[model samples]
Target: MRGFLASSIGVTCAAALALPLTLPSSGARAVTPATQSPAQRSAESVPGSTQSLPLISFGSDRSQGGGASREQGLHQREVKPFSLVGVIWDNPDDELNGSVQVRTRASGTGTWTAWQPVETHNHEHAADPDAEERASGRIRGSTAPLWVGDSDGVEIRVRGEAAEQRSDPALHRGEAAQHSGDAVEHRASAGSPAAAGQALPAGLRLELVDPGAEPPPQGSRPKGAPEALTAETAAASAVNADLAPLGADAIPPLSKKKTESDLIAARGGPEEAAGKARPYVGPRPRIITRKGWGANEKLREKKFAYTRTVKAAFVHHSASGNNYRCSQAGSVLRSIYRYHVKSSGWRDFGYNFAVDKCGNIYEGRAGGVAKPVLGAHTLGFNTNSTGIAVLGSFGYSNPPAAAVNAIARLTAWKLGLYGANPRGSTYLRSGGGNLYTKGKNVRLHVISGHRDGFATECPGIRLYKKLGKARSTSARLQGR
Candidate 1:
């Protein structure tokens, strides 16, 4: 166990130097195929990519009842082929008191789909107001991204509520406080009386994501052929080496007895190492590593931040909608990752892990999957908790049984690592949110829904209703 820790630490140090702060230009940038043999080239699949475009006002708004009720959007236009779409604005603290809708033309059919509403209440799925990440001044307000399948043309509309009028500063505390220059410029340009009623925040842009291509599956290389490793990929994969070989697609599950033995070894106390005390850890479940999903390692910040311990698990729905196939889960993940970092200004993917509709689990965010990695999810409750996002909107759609079962298996293993009971309750001091104020000690379920910690509707009603099953199953797996 000690040797495992030693090697992990060594590799982490060696790879840390290659961590990046900036993102690559808008496209997948994997190692050039020309530099590798045919086998290596085949192993390197096409990378995922994202394109960001700014949104412009539609036309004169006087024709739409009240003159103040204006709309911002793009008329029917062709763009690079993309499968997902969302909108973002400057100032993470601002609220979009409005409706956002989009319609897309199918990639090859030339037929356009009916306009769909994008989830607008997305502020609650973010870093707490006081975290260093929020203070970094890069965060942006975003609408939940929607999957549109493969599309080549699109149209969108964003119409703000016409009832209220307030100064731009009052619209966003963070922008007024930290980015006053940008705010002042916005206010000055939209100074007309009509614009004051429902003016949108500045720097609003549309994000079109092409979740590039899936990575080649494991064992695709010729027998005994060596695997290629970029420094970024190595850094992302090294943290999980304790559970799987470097660059492995997934961590193989362990038997209950093996899990207990490994848990004892990891604790490293003489008494615990002797296996005199029974550990309440569950058998590890298979988890797809970041490499398996074709994550652009260069798209995130270098260093990882962690809390002291994980006391709770917060579950969420991607809210990107349910228009994707299980085979495209990796592509969806890569798109979300790019959207989080490149489009929304987050340091990395917000959740600790993600589960596809088919129940396949994929690693989210960098850092060791076993560690207490701090995530920009479940605002006011990120500390001492891990976040898991089920990949789809579940508000109107019933969650798949396989997906719910996968959540149980995941929390059983991960929560057990910190001695947390999946069915029990715990207290987490709020870092500040709509439901709880800063420093408030709140009692919550160990396995809670995203809405339990924030005021937004997330993890949706259908998925949230199944928490009872997840908790019971998780406890049973832990042999409680």
Candidate 2:
């Protein structure tokens, strides 16, 4: 393990890009079953080529032995132009509060983009918020990674609020209260002691990811290829090939379903419909399972919760820049998974499902894909709504057609299970947030953008614009 040393370490660019990696590619990033060697698949994969940077601690401990821990920042460094970055804290216990944010500059002299906040409250996004796996000595708490586009020079700062824990007496009072059931619940919900005192974080880390150049094309091994090349590698390549970047056509839409109203009308009004039953369009969409995306379920604590039925599908954009290749989608998902649970302090991945740019769909949030698994995507609306985040930022970039269709198909199938109309509206009682303050019943389109229910510019302007289409297509697919 690296010591908690606050210093800059220069690393070779090659070494930084060499971690075991993966990103899957297939038709529309879809996987076609095939025999393959895991090693070969592993070689061609890995997302967000990264380098970890140490942070300098700040603040003077006010209360006990060494006072409260202070914050940390990274010295500016020159790196390969890249899009995504993340921050990590050395301590997992409740010692850090505040947030982690960063800014970057173009390596060739372009100006720096505004400092962006890395999501810190992502614990709710994990399958298990308090999983002991999160306490792994090999890992530390981290910030939800952000997509920054291509930038070379980067600087990071992790400042936290230390107001409440300034004195040991006050801090001790908190410790004394830890045994009460109320305190236990409080600790369970808000584990960050840093947040309790309103103090900044200390012993921090910054992670930079460069998706890197595309992999070498795979073809039959040369006659004189090294002995290391084997038939298993060929099989692996075939299995992983689907993960390659694909056009929108790779993922075909399911046949349309007849609308509930259309069915009623077709049966000659409510009187006739009362004696008839609805038709099943088909089985649910083929969800790329957690195993398909290589999620480590053991990393999560085993607890489950549920809402009755999902009433809405809130769209979102990953914001982690479009720096990834479709093949690298697996790695990207894993990074977000670990970051959400370990860094953000969420229960599981915030979304119920996720779509890659190539249009491949993956199950998220541990619960059954068709269940009303409450999420943390839209602050006041997670309970009855499913969150589906596209894998890349789309504020300015045009979201791929395949991704949009994937959302429609997913919602159509999932919502159809609950008999929800894609081209309709539903009311979700607000838990709390700017869009629907606590207890307010917010009515939203079945397929709404994250921005519709929250103040965030989530789902991005470009992607948000596509929700309308996704809704229509999803409805059509449901036979409406």
Candidate 3:
């Protein structure tokens, strides 16, 4: 899984170029290959072919206290048509008291290349004193030349285990097989234990295996002596005997029919259930509003003008401290607006709304549902989407629960007002042109930080992964 970090405006633009864009499916339309320009073709090809590039592995020793630990055991794989580029890793849990370093060498060469020190940190575990306690941190460092020739292969070596208590015992792994245009074959594995030794040669055979267990028999298990399993057989027999008292179908089947009690629980109360079960309860307006001049004034003052209302939402973070208050959130929004308008030369704040560490929603770039407006948060997507900026950076600290909840509530409100459905819409950006060009009656939709049509780590990697769940929650709340 790729993680996104909150970055400054300059870094955001640069990183955006490095990250892939996600598009909404309602607006997704396939463009013919013949219509693609050379640049587009190259951009599409790079991500697919770059995986085989040599990967450098670094070792970190975290046993030492206070002072920085030494890094050693740098290794690189030797393979045809490949060269070591660079290596990047993180001690997010700094509990390891470790250091990381990388070295590279040409394929088939005995002489090892000089080691390059990428990054080292000593205070990564400051929050916790127990060496066994799990900590949180990240390493974003990467090496150059992340690609090899057409037939190149790369190796990655990882040193130092995570703190025992924090280690992820489950080894989730996957493999892929590909056939080149010229009929050449290739194989790749991620997180697989066999990946280190079993090299596929000119053929496609993808396999998934458990890293913690012995590899499955390539053919079949060999015959073994019955005596070798006598104890195990006895244990199984005893367990069976113990379970014999329980009749067959010991577990009751799940009930499909809803009882009166179930209906009451589902509806919150009999009154609510009756209202929903029988309609014609006076005139129910489609829109709901809080009656207050102060609220209305706040809403109007926060509104701004844009070329057009966007079809999607661009998510981002301020990359600051987590100790944010509602009042301070307003100042952060002002600073972000000034930075984008005065420095980046944009029209007002780039985002439409800002969510604070306390999860308070503040008016941003101004426009709202009454008069949809587009902001410059997304280069090509501004015309069809809304931008929501979360206060504080996510690079070092995780988002607060309040902030996440506020985002969900705000998203639900926007989607309901726009009459968009969360289902039947894919959140991937690809092809040419905007995705909303084909959909009808598609008022509002939600997408990830990367999906707003630009790159960069706006929402951060951890938050990006939860986008689907967030959208679903918002939809359910809106009764969509």
Candidate 4:
């Protein structure tokens, strides 16, 4: 993802006179899906609920144009319940170029929608460092996943091409034209409307995750997990039947305790605190930790590291698919955590925190939710910023109001912790990348979309439009 000054297109929502004014609640009910009461397992794990569907690797890996790379895979002729779709491919050197096209049987009509394009310019959307461990394995590149609603039948074709071969006119005029068009379309896709129909790509392994058929009963959790529910988790996972927006404060605040910089903060005291960076506000959002989601911490090469101050919040949409229930949010984080570390070859998951469609916020890439745990998100701007990834791709689809409000709430507390206004401006020295050359001091809004820093279509155009709302709401929450 390239970063900086790529103006965001604004989105407006008009409130009709007939409609009542809606305000976010000061608090929300949370859910603790950590333990599945037997009843939940029995109720949710019904006749046909959870199942793994694998992608069929097509033609063998072959060299295209001398030493160029190309790979393909296919998934067809099967029926299974699933909400999300993703593509994974081995690209250790980050030289693989690929595309995917998919059509799913619509849950409503049982008919398939036209093949839609799953934005594939996800190459720059990561902090792909040249680490030794990363070079030694089956590292891969993936398209930002697509949400195809509830679908029983799906078809996918993936194709990968070498980076250098992108400009090879000798390959074929059609191929040349395709690359040319790709560049043009990508440049103009900023908050652009989705085309009536689009075709996916081929080249990587595809994954489909099912969120189960029904949500578990509240507090009616199965036995053995625990005899009680915390005010935090219970509220974070509550589902809104009407899909109304909730307050950013829906997530409970974290416990006040020693954080990653405890010793440093202690040494500084009140006088020192006043001299150094601005601290955030009290009553932080309850962030679901890596341990909470069962992370294999040892899988990473090193322990956590910290940046200076969190001057800005870069909003991003986790390239993962959008088909998820608040209950399955745990599974989504676990899979992404493993994939980011073991599969994508990063130290940990990229985003600092992840927000599900149902509005549950999960803590990501642990250091200290309160600490500036530098993440791999937004490439050049990782330092001095906290990345909040709303789970699911929002490129073509409109994000739920609940998700939007969650971003506001998380940012409201996190950004306020540093005594920064959610809607203010801050400057960060670029670490150097495609968007702004390294070392360039970039001025940005306190709350910015990922594309604002990177050239890639991150945080997605649809989600980008809501940044304005998030900023305003977050600022208001902070008493602006």
Candidate 5:
């Protein structure tokens, strides 16, 4: 399957060799290609770009009892093509106590789809309160990005909930009834006043992301004196050289025996490997490296962060929606990577690994895949845990069986390296979050959902439910 994917990608790249490639630049909305001036295409195609449109206050002003009015968003309008969308604000610390919904028109068809809900509880998927990344002035409060496919037109609404209602557990979990199409239509036709609630965070902007075309598959012909790779890129790729050739597109899979042998060798001889007893570890699964995914390594901080050990693995959904093709997984990852580092101001991609719908696993962040690289995922629990985000929204949609199995395979191998039992439990000290106070040691499953560590609907409801299957399968793979 991995070979097949690589071959397919090669063919695709061959066909698109003529397309201009560039590094990411910053910007927002422009005319569509069909009507775009040459200058517009040239600007939009500069690697990739984000169009940030400020969401304005709309609907009747109903401020009451000193509460701020609600319904802050932009009406439907045309713009440049974008495959992903999210809402971002000025402050990383301030919470957006509201619901966010957006409906978009397909770029070519001009057909608008039903309004999709954007996960509003994104604070829990960030760096610890005291982490340097969190302290950075550029970090912004952002909603989980929603993958809306290729869209040229958009309409969005952000409705804030009252302060008292904000305390409700249901609302925090995003379980309030969904905004239906008919209701939106009725509200638009009747001109009904939006419900008044708390004020949203300042500087709210709708971010439209075009992940840009996938980079030419690794090892293709040189494109005009190949751009010099940055020292940061070289350092990031160096960490994975043990598992793959430097600059290789992927680390090929190995059998259980080979993996065990490599594990023993890595422990500085067989004497310290599993205390003389044969290590019970799963086969090494194929992993696409960061370079394979076209990560602009220069965007991340030069220094890599590390933890003492990986005591647990946190599973999460990108919450970037499911409107993507397996072939485009690289693009989706690039967009999220850019969003994390460039837009949200994270030090790097938050998750350590990402699994696509087709069961392919991609190495995330810059640190070596084997290292206990600290991630800005699962909020307070990131100290000793690695995060693996499955691409797409899974709140209501069923996760693909392949993706779930990929999770099992990934966790089995990754956790087994640290001698963690996939089905067992471990203690993780909280760095502080809504769920656990600072300095508290909480016992949690070795393989836990994002919600298990924080008060957010991450890894989504449907995906969270499948963690059981992942755990058992992982244990079986580890020979436990």
Candidate 6:
């Protein structure tokens, strides 16, 4: 009853059917067919003996080169001398599930080997009692070694029901049929060590391999995932689409309005023709006077005389209270002076003059001197420009119409005295050059905000927008 199964290696035991067997007394036993069941008879005829019933052997007279092999009952096979190895289980019934252990030996003549475990389970019944049932059923599981050296090979072993029993009527009859799952193939390859250490160079060749099937769906994206849409990218894409139609060099020019004549034409003629002009104005700037020359008599008595004329003007806001009433405005000015002198430790008020919402001006720091006083307003320009403190904060509130008018008239008066023309536009601190010359001898009139001179947003965006209008009005008043 004994028979031999031919394999790539050599002759191995063949399963017996409807037969008996008798064991031989020497060398490898070949069981007699009459005395044993076909299964038992086939077991004895195997080269490695029944104890090693399922054995993996290298081909006869083949030089596998220092390879190793092991047989463990019907459940395990071990192979060596190979570096990259993996197992493939060809389950016809398709019920494959289990934990797998993989071991590998590094390259070189070194013996430091490591083992890691990976588990695979059926996604549908993973959490139920059926998991264990499926593990013990007709399903077959196998493990194969993965090697990573010059030569790669694997040794595979199977567990659970033997392949011969797969066709037994007793195992399948009268039982609910189970569908065979898809075949599971596990593979590993020896990757280049250099590839793992650094990024591949640009223009490297790559092969695109198609993944066979789709996996089951998972839930929503996790929190804190990056946004897929970006404004810059979207805008760039739109610009690219537009460029395809326009042939490049289609970028528009910069001017929003052509000129003053063009703006006037759009508005339908001059203000005088349209009867929208207001009455011609005369100078009505408020001025305060005090009769004092050098240091006071008290300072003379104390033997210290300091005489300094007002050479520059500084501008600021009260930043407290609205509409600049005389009493409240005066008090705010006093508080500012005290804060500057006591807290900031300055000589006197930071400004030489202050203007209220009522168009009233108050004398401060310097009183009745005709000379221009130096003030702390426009950083470098403060050496020459006079400081004028307007009564209320203009950051949020619009400058009152009266206040704007007064600023224009006052600037005109100052321009006349300084022999400067308000027509030319000069950036603050553009010293000495005749930025605007009426004939050929006029001086430059510089007007700008705190931020323009230094680096602060004191006058605020709302108020700073008025500078252009103020300049135009001042120029007209100065007969520029």
TM-scores, one per candidate: 0.84, 0.56, 0.36, 0.61, 0.82, 0.33
> Which residue pairs in candidate 5 have backbone atoms (N, alpha carbon, C) closer than 3 angstroms, thus clashing?
22-47, 28-51, 147-320
For candidate 1, what is the TM-score? 0.84
Give candidate 2 regions above 4 Å deviation. Answer: 1-54, 57-72, 76-84, 88-143, 147-275, 280-283
TM-score of 6: 0.33
> lDDT (0-100) at residue 303 of candidate 2?
42
Encode model 5's per-residue lDDT on 1-480: one tens digit a residue: 122112222121211111111111112112112332343223112367789899898754445434444668999999999888889988776777779999999988979999889888676788998887788787998988888888899999998776656553333455222211111111101111121243677788999988887777765756643333444445566556556654567877878777776666554444645557666778889899987888877677876776767789999999888888999898899888888877788989999999999999999977677767778988888887999999998988999999999999999888887889999888888888766677877778899888776666788889988989999999999898
lDDT of 2 at 27: 32
Q: Any idea what lDDT model 6 has? A: 0.31
Which scores better on lDDT, 1 or 3?
Answer: 1
Evaluated at residue 334, the lDDT of candidate 6 is 42
lDDT of 3 by residue, 1-480 (tens): 001111111121211122211111121232322333453233111001112222222322334333222322323444444222223222222122222333444445455544433222212101112111111122221211121112222323333323332222111101010111111121111222111211111111111111111112222335641111122112211111211111111111111122222223323556745645421111111111111000111111122333322245656664333444564444334333433332222334456666777666654543222224444444334444566767655644667777676666666555333344443242322212122221212222354453233223445555555566766766555555
Model 6 CA lDDT for position 156? 34
Question: How much lDDT does each candidate structure score?
Answer: 0.76, 0.56, 0.33, 0.56, 0.75, 0.31
| Tens digit of per-residue lDDT, candidate 1, span 1-480 | 343233323122334532321111112132322334554323334366677788887654574445433578888999889998999988766666678999999998899999999987777888888888788788998988888888999999988765354333224222121211212121223343333444566667889998886677888988988787665666777666656666778777877788778777666788887778877767888889998888877778876776767899999999999889999898889888888988888988999999999999889978767777788889889998999999999988999998999999999988887889998988888888765567877778899888776655688878888989999999999999
Could you tell me the C-alpha RMSD of candidate 1 in Å? 8.8
Candidate 5: segments with Cα more than 4 A from true spot:
1-46, 59-67, 164-167, 170-197, 222-228, 269-275
Model 1 alpha-carbon drift over 4 Å, by segment: 1-46, 59-69, 163-197
Stretches > 4 Å off in candidate 6? 1-284, 289-315, 321-324, 367-369, 426-445
Model 1: how far residue 335 lies from native, Å? 0.4
The segments of candidate 4 whose C-alpha lies over 4 angstroms from its true place after superposition are: 1-71, 75-85, 92-98, 102-117, 128-139, 146-155, 159-251, 254-282, 294-302
Model 5 TM-score relative to the real fold: 0.82
Measured with C-alpha atoms, the lDDT of residue 297 in candidate 4 is: 41
